[model samples]
Target chain A: MSLTTDDVNKIAYLARLGINAKDTASYTENLSDMLKLVEQMSSIDTDNVTPMAHPLDTIQRLRPDKIIEDNQRDHFQSIAPQTEEGLYLVPKVLD
Target chain B: MTMHTKTLKQLSQGLQTGEYSSQELTLAYLNRIQQYSALNSFISVTEAQAIAAAKQADALLTAGNAPLLTGIPMAHKDIFCTQGVKTSCGSKMLDNFIAPYNATVVDNLNAAGMVSLGKLNMDEFAMGSSNETSFYGTAYNPWADNTVPGGSSGGSAAAVAARLIPAATGTDTGGSIRQPAAFCGITGLKPTYGRVSRYGMIAYASSLDQGGPMTQTAEDAALMLQAMAGFDPKDSTSAQQDVPNYSTNLNNSLQDLKIGLPKEFFDEGLNNDMATAIETAVNEYKQMGAEIIEVSMPHLKLAIPAYYVIAPAECSANLQRMDGVRFGHRCDNPEDLNDLYIRSRGEGFGTEVKRRILVGTYALSAGYYDAHYIKAQKIRRLITEDFTKALESVDVIMGPVTPTPAFGIGEKTADPIEMYLADIYTIAINLAGLPAMSIPAGFIDNKPVGLQIIGNYFAEAKLLNVAHQYQQVTNWHQQTPKGFE
Candidate 1:
């Protein structure tokens, strides 16, 4: 269950985090230790046991379709890092 | 007694009897915060806002319209959103971000006329077992200078223990609230999942994360929980059940109380001194005509493994919203959207947070979802079943809140596995979605030991009653940290 440097890099990339080359060794070591801890779960028998996502085992409670919150887009967008003309601005994804 | 030394209940009485004004009380606490600044307990102090709120509370008191919490001052863990104030969540990611609205708990406490002193420090995004992971810096244990106040609600516990505030709000995902409460020698409750609305609290692990009260006594916790609990339409997961009057049962006799001792909790991991303190607390309960039964949770050993997977998996999803565009920390310059996300998250988050995100992402990654995430979920079901079967014959379960008392600040940080093990005794209850609390039972080697009392779902009142009855005869809860007094 030891994570290689490549695996650490992949995980960081998947998580949308950029790890410097210097930290990769520590990340691999730390993540490998964590995975080793998680490896213990494989020894337990979970045969026929249902996977419990929510503790209560309840589904999301749906509300009637209605407008509950008043429009506060401007107020909400006030904290945005970059915004222009009522839209959030991000680095271009399309050329 | 000065306002800082008084318990929430006493402070409430003082305000009611006109012995002191809320403004005066608020100023006294603010002064204490200044004097105890070395503890690093608070991240933000809203002195002006606190004074203004105190004035409004005073007006309410004069009008005879004050609630029980009126004029009482407290601090909130930075995890809960506070409008117009920085809710840092102890991470640089949100250090400059001001909450646009109040968390439901904050709103409810405010509506009850309680004055908030400010935002307290915590483990970054409530991730670590010790407060050392906070972006603001580690919060020192008020009881001892070099030791850590157990976290991720470390500051909440430290501030209350230091008498800087009578009580503070804390959220427990695994053991954040209770462990810190134990470490700082105070009372903390983590109510059943959905018992308190989680509307604006920053999400870590949505299923296991629950907000509760951290105070000097169970009675104070009861008062705080009364104000904080209730269904909120905004939070769909909030339970629709009626919030019970937790204070009403505090004086109930412990006669015939069937307490179960989980054998696994007393096994190899528990420190010998902690075991003795927990055993002494159990004997006290036995002397009160309570019946103690031994229960087995064989799969308890699997809790740490299961929690690591499930919590991280959920955390990865929840924290996805923290991407640089809408809010939170954004990088200085970005060549592309991918670069923005990668650098913003990498630079903005602390080491622990980044580690968890990486772990979570790997657990939920395309090729590994079933082997890791699904298997962890199945193990979670087994752990929950263990509690269900044990609770069938017992009124509540009792154990050590943590494997040992508070350790040195940097003791477990070097090894993530060791830090993860610190939460072993407290994680299963979260997995079970049950109500549990930690009360100051005794001290070992000058550090505090907490006796963990666990109850069935929606059984907060019962848990409070159990802890309250114990506090009635013991002086442990009354012992304040030295010099801070």
Candidate 2:
């Protein structure tokens, strides 16, 4: 289970991280080394084992849909990198 | 006694009796933090804010309506949101991000009138075993300057050990709190998963991450944990179980207490001196009337691999929200949204964080999901069952916190596998959602070794009891570093 440079690039793209050509070699080496360690799990027989997501075998607790929190849009937007009139401004998507 | 040298219990008593005001105590800690600035323990010191909170605590004391922790100053790991304070999570990405609201842990402690000194440093997004991964430089172990303070809670552990503050809050995903506590010669607890509310505490791995106390003694950790643990409506995963008074059981007799020594923990990987230190502590437990039994955890060897897969996979999902638009670090100039996301994250995150995110993304990618994520989950179940079976036989499991004492800085940074293996003995408890604590047992080559006591799910009181009892018979927890003292 080794990651090629291309695989590292693709994974980086999916993860929304940029990797230049030089760094991709290091990423490939590190990710491949990690994958090698992870591959140790493949030998175990987990045919009957249940996949444990949470530590406790509990389901996610649901809450009433009613509004419990007041609107703090302005307060939140104050910390945004680019905001105007409580609207976060990102690069143009439809352009 | 110097205010910095006093325990949380003593500080509380002093404040209540008017021997010293909260203002005076907060000043003492702030002064110490400044004096010991080279340890790199604190990321941000809230001098003005701490003094203001101290003034409020004094007012509460005057009104005779103060909480147990009123006026006692401490630090929170930067992972917890601190309202107006910078919550960096020891990452460059969040270096400029000021939290809009308090984390539930911070709010709970603040409501108790506990004065926070500031935010302690940690591994970037809590990724590394060594503090070297911190965007801020490594927090040096106060005991040995060249040795690394075990982390991602290294800064918290080092601060507590250095007596910059009596205690500080720390989080553990894979031995972050306990390992650092072990390295720094302090007591740290990792309560059961969901024991403390995670609301506003930056998430690293939702399922395995838990916040706990790092302090001089298990008794202080008990007091801190009592305030920090409970259900919060804000955190959906917060357990609804009734919070127990952890301090009440501290003096409980260990008579006939069953302690399980897992056969796997004492394997060849454990260093000779660490094994000796752990054995010495076990002997002390035996003398105190604990009945020791050998227990076996067959899947214990697989904990590191299982944890790496699961924790990073979860981190990958949790960190996706850190796109430059809403908050956190953004590039100066971006050509487009995709460019914004890529460059901001790539440039903002440290090497270790990026590596984990990459591995996680690869693991969760279309073809590899079953082989990596699902298989890891199943292994996690096996590890949990192994703990369950062992705990059914004994009241607690005792082992060495780390394979050895703190290693020198940069010794293992180049090898990710070596760094990951540093957590082998501690990661299984998180996977099982059990409560565990690390107490300073003794020294190996002038560095402290920790004895880890692991309890059943929600048995934090029992774990604290075991640690507190051990602390009672030994003065290891009281030993401070040379210059810090």
Candidate 3:
């Protein structure tokens, strides 16, 4: 399917990516071309086929709830763009 | 002695025999890295850490016994996190990010006593086919400066090809390792899905990503694999099965080996020169008592489209963690949370990355999810089944690593689809989650071509042996670029 400017804008919003107004036309064209390539999948009939997730067909392994990781909050937060009081600081949303 | 031309075994022997020391080897490599800066192979040359590690390796060497990779100077693809060093993954997003911990693969290599020279450059977030997408800048091929060295493992392959380092680590998701290895005339293996831990290796397409070795020979690749491949509890998807002694089977005979050549791989899409090289390599296998048979992969053509959908869809999800609040790039003075995310991502990600994120978002979005994402997954299963059916009668599958040898740097950048089609032969194997490798087969117009060997799941040892047997009778892997020699 061809992606229009509106479609590109909507998808960029969903992806949380800012497409500069200048680059939107190019983005739309590129995404449309990629979609055209992806459109080849329609040629095959996959009605009975089961969608595969992991290549090995293995289920995600889970471990019991326990704190195996040491608290490195300080070291981790030290690399953040902004952090205060042991939490990442982002622009105010609720306020 | 030309230290850079030495094989892993030769280097190991030199260290043990007291003819050379790891410290000297690392210093030599550091000097060479500087000399070859025009190639843009390295992202960060960890000179101080490398010397310190080499001194430690010398101590180990004096202590009598160390791993095969001990005292060896190598580099990790920037995609792998190295503690206390920048792990950019070739994107502006993580340019300032220093990984707090080493990836499991890095830990594995370190424990093997390998001295890490530094991290090599790669396509941004492992997104592009060529290193041009790298924020660090384009990496040049050692063989021909005008052509790409194949990517996102371009730097790893280029450095090894240029003999800047004896070997390096590379990850493959959709031909990253093999293609570059081919372009740069080296050996690269992508172990079976989950055969190696993904704990520290950055995720691209989770199911398709596998970390292996990029080396000068299959034997070296096998030796490196011995260290890198194993089950890791840290990576849930890491296989629970034991990693075989890959080095042990390097001399195994290929007698009566039932080799399968997929018709799809030999079709018109393949360039004449590459096809001739692959055919000649396959003939060499036949001369070694291997039986060749033609196999059909009816669904092979669909790989590119399916890969485009699934990889991007998964990448969109995987890259979400890169928001401004995290350790990655943050834009200045964001008005609010949404603006912080959009602007940070827009400014941080390159053109190709943004394009993929957008594509992925469209695929996974409402109403179109099944049409694109689910359909791709279904097609993935079909491609895997085709491999299974073909492998039922063959010991291994052989094909060309790329349709053509390395193209000029900006040759295909104008059109993204053209670049995506370059991965047709290699993507099917990743989609099937099988083990594969690309060994230097021959040169086409001075640019190296790779012979791809694929095997069933968990067949890394067998694949390495296959490439090893070929290398035993061939010198393609030993060929270095003119100035490099």
Q: Which candidate ranks first by lDDT, i.e. highest?
A: 1
lDDT of 1 by residue, B359-462 (tens): 99999999889989999999999999999999999999999999899999788988988999889889999998999999999999899999999999999999
Give every candidate's TM-score on chain A: 0.94, 0.92, 0.92
TM-scores vs. true structure, each candidate:
0.99, 0.99, 0.99
Lowest-sum lDDT 10-residue window in model 1 chain A: A52-61
Please give the fraction of native interface contacts (Cα pairs under 8 Å between A and B) kept by each candidate.
0.94, 0.93, 0.93
Candidate 3 clashes: the total is 0
Model 3, stretches more than 4 Å misplaced?
none
TM-score of each model's B chain? Answer: 0.99, 0.99, 0.99
Predicted candidate 2 versus true structure: per-residue lDDT over B1-485, tens digit per residue: 57788899998999998999999999988999999999999999999999999999999998896888999999999999999889999998999999999999999999989999999988899988878899999999999968899899999999999999999999999999999999999999999999999999899999999999999989999899999999998998999999999999999999999999999999999998899999999999999999999999999988988888899999999999999889999997899989999999988998899988988888898988999899999999999999999999999999999998999998998888898987989999999888899999999999999999999999999998899998889999999889887
Worst 10 residues of 1 chain B by lDDT: B1-10
Model 1 CAPRI quality:
high
Q: What are the RMSDs of all candidates, in order? A: 0.8, 0.9, 0.8
Which pairs of residues collide in model 2?
Answer: none
Runs of candidate 2 with Cα error greater than 4 angstroms are none
Model 3: lDDT of residue B271: 95
Give one digit per residue, the lDDT tens place, for model 3 in B195-303.
8899988888888899989999998988898999898999989899977888888788999999999998989999998888899999999999999999999999999
CAPRI quality of model 2: high
- Provide DockQ values for all models, in the order shown: 0.89, 0.90, 0.90
Docking class of 3: high
